[model samples]
Each structure stands twice: as C-alpha cells, then as structure tokens.
Target chain A: MSTPALDATLAPAAGAADAATPGTARARTTAGLRGWAVRLGSLAVVVALWQWLTATDARVGLRFDRLPSPTEVAAEFGRQLGTGVYYLDLAQSMIRILTGFALAAVAGIALGVLVARSRWIGDLLLPPIEVVRPIPAIALVPIAILVFPTDEQGIVFITFAAAFFPIMVSTRHAVRALPTLWEDAVRTMGGGRAHVLWNVVLPGTLPGVFGGLSVGMGVAWICVISAEMISGEFGVGYRTWHAYTVVDYPAVLVGMASIGVLGWVTSASIELLGRRLTRWLPRGEGSAR
Target chain B: MSAPAAEAARVDAGLAIRLEGVSLGYGPHAVLDDLNLDIAPGEILVIVGPSGSGKSTVLRAIAGLLTPRAGRVLAEGVPVTGPSPDRAMVFQDDALLPWRTVRRNVELPLRIRGVPKRERRTAAESWIARVGLAGCEDRLPRELSGGMRQRVQLARSLAGTPRAVLMDEPFGALDAQTRGEMQRLLLDVLRDTLATVVFVTHDVDEALLLADRVVVLGRGGIGCVLSVPDPRTPDIDRAGLRARIIEEL
Candidate 1:
C-alpha cells in the first residue's frame, strides 16, 4: 500500500514536460547557425591568411615566395579536375584503400575472435602479432616491394598491414572485456555456445571494434600514401611526389589539399557508420548515478 | 496491452530443489560444506547471510551454473547438471544486455527455445506491460532508470515460465524507496505464478517480508532457519525471529 503512495507522490513532479516552446526553438536554431558560422569562419580566416602570405610573399619568419598562392592552387585544382588522369589516380587510390581495408576487416575480425575465444590459439598467434605490430607498416615498403610482383599489390599489402593490428587487437580486447553476466544469463536460459557468441560476444564488442576501425582507417591512409610515394607508378601519393619532382608547386598544393579532404571524408564516414551501429549506446544521457 | 494470464501462470506448482550433502566452492576455496537443504515447491525461501557466506554459491548450484565439489543438487528428483531454462537466475546488477531493447531482452529465452517470432513478440509485450513498462518496448537498458531496469529483468526472467527463479539481491542496488516498491511489485508479480523462489538478500527485513522460510547462512553453512508468519495476520508477532536473525549475523 505504501509502495503505491510513494510512487504516486513522486509521479506529479517526475512528469516534467518537454518544455520546448517557440521562443526556445528559435534560440536553438540561432545557436546552431552561430556554431556553423564559427567553424566556417575559422577555415575562411586560415585560407585568407594563406592567400595574403603567398600573394605578398611574406617572410615573417619563413619565406613564402616559393610557395603557391591560393588562386594558383585553385586554378591548378580546376585544371586537374578537368583531366581524366586525375580521376584515374583518384579511382586507383580509392580502389587500393577499399580492397585492402575490406580484406583487413574480414581477416582481422575473424582472427581476433579466434585468438580471443581460445587460449591456446592466443598463445600461439598473439606473440608473433605483437612482435610485428610495433613495426611501422610504412617501414614494410622494402619487403612489400621485394615480395609482390606489382606496385599496386604492394601498396595494398602495406595498407592491410597497417590496418590489421589495430582492428585485431581492439576486437580481442573487446571480446575478453565482455561482462560474464550476459553469458551466464543466456546460458541459464538454455542458450548454447552459438547463441552466446551471437547474442553476447559480437554485439558487446561492437563499440570497441568500431573504435579500432576508425583508428585503422586513419593509419591505413597514412601507410598507403607513403607506400605510393615510395614505390607506386600511379595514385594520389605518387602524383603528389611526381608534382614535387617536376617543381609544379600549385599541383603539389592541390595534391596536399585533396589528401586532406579525402582523409577527413573517410574518417567521418567511419565515425558515422560506427554511431549507427551502436545506436543503443546512451549517447549523451548525462549525469552519473 | 493484454496480461498473459494463462501462459504467465503456466508454471503450475514449480519444482522441489534439494541439496544433498553438497559442497560448493571455487577452485580450492570451499564456501559451503556438507550442506543439506530442501526447497518446497511454490514456496518463497529467502537466504540471508553476511558477505562470503556462500548464499549466492548455493543459489548458483541450484541454478546448475556451478558444480558441487561433493554430493549433488536435485531438481524434481533429477540430478542438476548444466544450466536449463527451467531455472532462471536474476542478478543484483541488472543483466539486461545493453545492446538489446526491452522487448528483445524479454524475448531472449523464448527465442532460444525456438518459439515463433510472432508469439515471442506478443509474449514479450505482454510481460513488458504487466511490469508497467507499457510504452518502453523499444528502449535500451541504458536508457532506463535502475528501478525500471530491474522490472525489465523481472519480466524477462518470468516471461520464460521457469519452474524455479533464483534471485541474488535483485533490489540491493536500488534506493530505499524504490526497493520497497520493487518488493511490493515482486509480490504482486509472484501472485500470477507458482514458481519456486530462492531469494538471497543481506537485508533481514526483506527476507521477513517475502519468505515463508528464512535460511540464515554463516560460517560457510546454514546458521539457522526461521519460519516467518503471515504478516497479514494481525495477532502474530515475529520480533524475536527478527532479533535472532540479526544476532546470527
């Protein structure tokens, strides 16, 4: 009897209305617009500063006389965009990344789950993986060049190597870190080994696996570009290196800017995908209790 | 929002659980030794003990999650082996999977048993509503309050129509007021089924309120067993029983 009284007494105060009104909604929109303005404004300021320094050839502490101006880079960017070769390079680089990343995702997740699931497998496999993990994937360019017949394959291998360790390691940790309570709960309810794996281990590891994926994507980009620069006959990194050799300063600037955009876009996509996959996470359900 | 009146009460009289000279432990550390006990069908038996008294270990053995070092546990005259759907265990920590929505969590046991998808959904929603979570079918565990999460756990456990339910301080983590409500709600829910309950709690008051038989565990074994009178009777007094339980601790 007292239980109902306790709940009912608290219920009136607990039912806090959403409280959003016309005035607050307008305020929220204004705040959002202001936030975008600040972000875009910051980028515009940096571009304007760069343009001024290059156009005037300012040498406050370092010389900008040899660097390409914003207009020069923009014009070069437009010219490159019109050419079929530029698109080819873009496609080649993207294909290499996608192929390597896809292969790595499959293998890393499989091996990670395998090693984590069985103790003997972990003992046998983890030692060699840990040994190789610390060595930079870019540093493997020499071995890749020697072992692979084609530069394309070598670059892809490098990307795969760069991405594999992070994904594997994070997945392993995620699996091991899962709460035993879940497994026990399922088991008590007559769930078998497969059910435990499907219901608990895999879903529980998603957040950690995605965390590694985002990091692996970033690292793979780094190694792929370096591998291209070192050994590739084509691709964005190769083209950028070629521009440098030819002293096409504006083309080099265009390459650098394009790489920046590509990296940002890929990473942003990974994060968005990760967020969608783990939508059940509390997000910003604030406060500790 | 229909109450699953028929299926919810499907566990007719529950199973009789027996521990015959059972010795339970974890790898060289003995928690209970030569313990013998019998849990009556459809009875609420509460085990109260100080920390490390193996109250939970005993519950685990009956739930068939732990193997006794010596002797055996029998459920309905059959030797208990591995975990079975006939016995469901609820933990103090809300063990609802964080990734699963309320409906899916409630549907897990049914799904494991190969129950049809449509029927499982209907059963899950029925239990969800019966537990007073009518509109929270899609909410994740993390989105719910602690008390609400416990309610979901209760629904999830009972939805399976288990013969015996083992609860390990299921409301120990709640605030005082919420704990009281949960206790009330548990009694209300139990009225719908004849499942045997082995509730382990540190709170003596909780045991007195819920149990037909209160077993006090101490020194790695049963210290005493007290029978709680129906509190609804205006003339019966059990103050001495409460004091004995407190003194045994």
Candidate 2:
C-alpha cells in the first residue's frame, strides 16, 4: 500500500547494512557466536604472550623470573581440585562470607527503616554509624584483631563492616523515596503503623534493597579475602598468601582464580534472587541484557 | 467573603461533614483561608475549580490526611484528627500496590478491619466483579491499563462501605471516553449506597453530571454554591451553567 516516496523513505540508510537484514534466530545465533569467538581469541592471545615471555629467559628486557606460565598454573589448578585441603579452604571462606553477609542484611535493613521513619531514632543512631562507615575494612584490621578473640571472628567482622553500609544507605533512600499516597491510602483504610510498614514500606523498598545486596556481596568477598590474607590461618585468601611466602607461584595463581570464580558466582546468585522477588517489575530498557 | 461562612453553611444534625472556619497553609503560603462547607449524608458534593484553587487540599482536610492551621473539620459528630476507616479516599493517581494483585489490593481495607480471610476474599471478589475486573484478579497494577487501575482503586475505596468517600481528581488521567464511562459506572455503583461523596475535579461537565451541589472554590475560599436541580437530568442548560462556572473561576 506504500507509495514510491514512502518506499524510498522506509529504505534503510546506506551505512546501516546490518539493520537491513531481519533479526531472525540464525542471525542472533551468529552474533552470539561471534561475541564468544572474540572473547576466546583475546584470552588465547594473552595466554600465548604469557607463555612466550616465560618459555625462555631472553624474550623481553623486563623479566619476571618467578612468574608461573599458563600451563603450570593450569596443571596446579587440576592438582588443587583433587585435594581435600583445597575444598576445606573454599568452604571456610564461604562460611565466613555467608555468616557475615546474613548478619549485615538483617541489621542493615532494621537500622535503615528506623532511621528513615522516625526523627528521634535517626538523631540517636545515625551519628556514630556515619563516623564508622567511612573507614575502609582493610583499615580496621588492627582494631578488629584487638576486639575479637580469634582471627576468624576478626575476618567475619571485616566482611560484615564492608557490606553493612551499602545495604543500610540504599534501604534508607528506598524508604524515604516511597510515594506518600501509598501510606495515605493505607491509613485511610484503617491500617495502623504496623500495617503500613507491612503493606507499603517493606514491599516498596525491596528493589533498592536487592541492589544493595548485589553490591554488598561483591564487597563482602573483597573484605573477607583481604582479612584472610592478612590474619587468617585457613581460607582461600590465606592459602594464596601462604603460597607466595613459600614461592609456589602456580599455587598462588590457582588461589586467585578460585577467589575470582567464587566472587562471580555469589554476586550472580544475589542478582538472580533479586530478579525472582521482583518479577512484577517491567524490565527497564537500559537493563535489557 | 473573607470571614468564615460558618453560619450560612450550617447543616442539620445528620450532616456528613462540616468545615468550620478552616484555614490551611504551607509555611508562609496560605492555600485555604476560613473555608466553610457542609454536606448532608447520602449526597454527592463536588468541589470544582481551576488549578491552585485548593480543591484537593479541601478533600485532604475532610479525609483527615492533612491538618488545617485553624478551625475544625467534623465528620458525623467527631472532630477530624487523623485518617479513619469510615472516610475512604480515591486518590488522583491509582495507588494500588504494585506488588499485590488486583484482588489483594481491594482486600486490603477489609484486612485492616480484621475481617477473616475467607470473608474478605469473598467480599473482594464481589466488589471486583461489580467494578468489571473479575477475570483480572491475579494481575498486578503494572499489567493493567490506567483506566483499569483507576477502576481497581475505586473498588478498593468502596470495598469497606465507608460512611464517606473523598475523591481527588480520581479520573483526571483517563481518556475522555473512559472518563465518561467511569463517571456513569460510579453513579450506577453508588445508586443504592448511602455514602456521602466529596469529589474534587477541574472538569465542569463532570461536576454538573455528578454533584447534588457544586461548590466553586476561588483562590482561597468559596465563590458560590450552585444546585444541579437533578444530577441525573440537569433540567437547566448544562453548557450555560458550565460557562457560569468558568466565569467564576
């Protein structure tokens, strides 16, 4: 039904060749494969350069004599996967992270709601927390060691400190940003303060709370690993530092890789849980991927 | 007109609302000054005016969602201090809980009243059906159209069978056709109920169509009170009255 002029206007621009083609399933698959190929190719090039640098002693002016080649690190990774000690270290790190993160989640949300909802509570509580919040978890090492009886508890405290602020700050903003009409509607329906909290405040603030949780999970991993490296006797972080001290460069790389994988998995899990809880929300255009 | 019109606005003992010398302001800015009005039980009183005329503020005062700087707002015989279950409000924006399904949102007032689960669910279902949302019970507010969401809000407000209903531009966002349909639907639904309604709108036609009496509010207080003669059939030239209201504004 289009006229010649309309057809001309509808035609794709000359430089937009990709846009001219329909975005069918096969096209999507090809695009996905291309993305993977590029990523794998970049990784392979890095590995080859690393292998070349350490294959012999004379490849470059800058020499890393203690650096382990990719092959040696891969071999050590396989051996570590076979050992019970490796599993124990991984489990220890997980236990500390989960325990600390759980404590932070509960306390953070409680404090956030209290501060946001009541002026008296905000005045009484916020000052000390604001002072404590700016200090980094790494900076708290000496004080934590002195306060806690064991290194394990000190590491857990560091992890908790890392996560607590993000969750608390985000939840406070979430509660404050709620539409007044929602509370008004509840109150006019004979709902008391408790009912308003249950029906309006809690559910309304969940998306922001989950955003905090995701960021907190990533930060928790960093704090726990750093704490373990400096003070702990048995964790992935401790194992990594111990390997470096003993000059087992391949083992150190293995430990680093383990920590990286663990952090990625935990952060992904938090995001997945957030998505499940907030299925009613329409996916924003910016969050398409 | 600056003085409180309390004596002239006095109503009988069975009046639904009485605003006596009510003055409201925000910081240094006054919104309503010495505003006096009254509504009898089972009447549809519409407050219509231009933007910034404090129409919605008056509704909020009656609903006890906002406190006035001076004077009293009495509902039945009780002086308004805070929101009560007997005075439900339909907000301009559909304030249905985004996480809750349509049925659950409508069931909220009953839940607050401590009605048992089975009874509240049944009551909510009946009201949803009355509002033409029976099949969409499980749909969240985000999934529904704006008109549909407004219907859910209306159903939620009426579910409690409140003694008074305060509405602030409840259908101001709907398309013209949908707005007309909703106005008709409101009348149909409230035909048998004896609830007093204080509906606020900028739409003169909507006021003439719905109100037993229309209170035209100016910058700070009442301009005039015009009776519709018969809301269902205005008998007078509706356009002429609309023009008169436009002039007053």
Candidate 3:
C-alpha cells in the first residue's frame, strides 16, 4: 500500500554510501566483473564437454565424424585464415547480408508507417503481406533465382525477403499499439501531423521496431546461408556445401562456426544501436534478455 | 496575494465553464442527459459522484476528448471544439514518457510548441526543482517513485501555462499519504497561479480538501454544488468536510 515509504527508507542508505567515498563506484565495478567471470566459467564447462565427446571414439552414425571437434574446427579456421580466402568470403557474405538488411529496414518501416496511419493503404497492402508472410524465406530462393539474372542478386533478394516481413509486421503493430493519448498530447501542444510522426510516433515505436529488426537479422542470416549453398560462386555457405560434398567434416564445422559468430556480431551491433537511440528508455534487463 | 484582484479576476467574473443542456451517449445508451453547470474563473471545482455518474464524462467533454450528442461546452466564453493549449489534463496514470528523463518529460509540451531550446530547458529545470526533483532531473520516469512520477506529470501540465487544468483522479493511484501530499502541492501550485481547475474524484475528503466548490452529480445533471464556507488552505479539516459531503450524498 505504501511502497514509497520503503523506497524512501532505502534511499538514505544509498545516498550515505554515495557521499562517503568514491570507492563505492570501484566496488560496484568489481562486483559486475565477478558476475561476468561466473558466466564465462559456465561457457568453459560447455566447451570442455564438447572436447571430451570429440576426443573419445563415439559409435553414433555421424557423431564426431560429421560434427567435427571444436579443436579441429579451430585448426581449420587457422589454416583458412592464413590463405585469406576465408576472410574474403566472410567479407562478401557480410556485405550481402548487411546490404539486404539495410534495404529491408528502410522499406519495411516506411510501408509499415504508411499502412498504420492510413486505412486505405492498410486495406490495399495488408492482405498481400499476410498472404505471403507464412511462406518461408528459403522457399523464395527458387523464385529469386528465376526472377534475377545473377546468383548474387538472387541471394540478396532472398535475404531481403527474409528480413522484410518481420520488420514490417512489427513496425505496424508498434505504431498501432502507441497510446492514443500521446498523439492527443502532441496535438494539444500545437504539433502538426508531420511533427507528431517525426517526434512522437517514431520514437514511441522504436523499441518494437528494433525488436523486429533483431529477429529479422537472425532470419536474414539463415536465408543468406541457404541461398549461398544453392547457387553462390564463393561464400561461407558455398564453402560449407562444397565441404559436405567432398566429405570434409572439419571444414563444414568451421563454416558453421563462422556463420554463428557473424550472426551474433551483427545482431549485437543492431542491439547496441537500438540502445543508443533509445537512451531515454528506463533501465531494465527485460529487453536485453 | 491581493484578495481584491483575485476576486475581480475570479468571483466577480462570469463563469469560466458553462455546460448547458448537455447530453452525451455512446451509440444507444445515454451517459449524461440535460446536464448544466457553471464554474467560476480561478476556482477549483471538484465533481464528485458514484462510479457511473458521468463526473469523468463531464471533464472529458470540457477537455474535448469526447463529444456530447447534445448541448455545448464553453471555456472562457469560447465553444470547446477539441483539446487546446488553453486546457491541460493530468491523466490518472501519470502518463510521463518512460524513455524521457524528468527534465525532458517536463519540457515535452514546450518542445512540441517549438519554444527556443535554451528558454525551454530553463523553464523545465525550474519546474523540476519546483516539484522537488532537482537532483533527479536526469533520472528516467521508471527510476522515480509513483509520487515522484505524478509530480513530474503535474510539472509537465503546469509548464504549458494553460488557462485551466483538468485532473481526472490524478492521485487515485497513489497511497493515502502520498495523495495527501499531492493535494497540498496542488493547492500550493493553484495559489501561485490563476489556472481554473476542474478536478474529478470519488474520494469525499479529497474533493473537500482541494475544491472551493464541490459539484455532486447523481444520474446525469448536477445534484448540488456545495461552496466551502472557508477558503482552501493547508490547514482545512478533512474530517469535517467529509462528513458534510457524505450527508449530502
């Protein structure tokens, strides 16, 4: 009934500590470091289990043979890095994914805002999006190849197709879900429609839009890989497919590791950007988790 | 403050708000019918009634958030069309943007009005300090307690410098002590400004504590308007006012 009283009581203790000395800041930093160490220790245990499975002779149909050990994959990565072809392929793959992702983000957000604000646009465009959204991005590979002249264009198209729907749908939902009072508040303050869109509606929808972008990036990676494996001249996905054809299981594992790391880095970058843009957002671990 | 000037600007002037033969309905069912009331300028008018007594609807009509099927709403002799800068509302939920710091939240109306940045920031900072959030200007709304957030909301509405303020159970979500402090703060703020206030509340004590004239609504129209014999002050007896309102109810 009176949580403010409890908070008021606790506030003084924190204020006292803050005023006492600067050492409290260092102490908090070290405590955060300790938390990170615990998380890393658990990750090490998982790596140890993987190593043990690979070192032992497993009798399953495709245990260590098909799924190469971490060490084996690492060695393959080292050799590939020395040749520098792997880096080139990695760069090409990243460019394709990023370019397609950027295009999707722009187009999706624009269309989403349009549909959310106007009923006529929503009626005209929403049905087509809903009808096609359920069809997998991978399934678009064949269609992309038929529609585009080159393999590169086809793969990029597939990646774009993968990311666009999620971002669009999420943006639309976010726009619609904004509190009606916010718009009224802006209007009362003499803001026009354009001003409201730029200042209030866009900022209000960022959290949800970024949520969609994160998911879209993950799916974009999947589709990019599948598209490359099907028809790419040279890419991580193509190399992985080639390794499988030649029975080079270690090389295949290395490719999978490369894809995973790339996906993680890209997604994390987008998340960081989101946080920077929404700096006014309240502190909570719920969004990150 | 000069009582002569205050009376000339408030009591001596005609009604600031007039709702005449107002009827409102949603599709089929009428919520308010044949309602009429007049609130003097610079007066704190509290509307108290049962759950579905259209107390809030009257405020909504005045704010132009809702339209009445019949009759008219006027503010300062001008017909109310929609939400305007002349009237500001403090919602029940505080409604401070979670992403904005206290200072930024208070500056929202100014920013929308395209007020110069330096002037807006100074105004916002002054109000932040006014509401007792001086040291926490950079803190987000989530970082503040419920009472602090509500204080920020009040500061935001005040920053606009509207002719009148509409508060729809603004302290209804707060605890008893916090609510009391807020009521006192509201009185303090009202004393310093000429903004006419239309407060809607179900709490009899709250109605008595903050209002100069308490208007009770029964089914649709005004049941009664009780003028407090004593002017609003920090030391008013809540128990005495509550007994008076309960008897009327």
- Best by the DockQ measure: 1
lDDT of 2 at A24: 51
Tens digits of lDDT, candidate 2, A213-234? 8888889999999999999889
In model 3, pairs of residues that clash are A280-B99
The residue-by-residue lDDT of candidate 3 on B135-167, one tens digit each, is: 998888777789998899999988987778888
Question: Native-contact fraction for each model?
Answer: 0.89, 0.81, 0.43
Rank ordering of all candidates by lDDT, starting from the highest: 1, 2, 3
lDDT of each residue in A100-217, candidate 3, tens digit only: 9999999999999999999999999989888989999999877897999999999999999999999999999999999977676666555678867986789899999999999999
User: Candidate 3 - CAPRI tier?
Assistant: acceptable
In model 1, state the lDDT of residue A75.
99
Give the distance in Å from residue A8's predicted Cα in candidate 3 to where it truly belongs: 28
Candidate 1 lDDT tens digits, B47-101: 9998889999999999888999999999999999999999999988859998899
State how far residue B29 of model 2 sits from its true place (Å): 2.1
- Write the candidate numbers in order of decreasing DockQ: 1, 2, 3
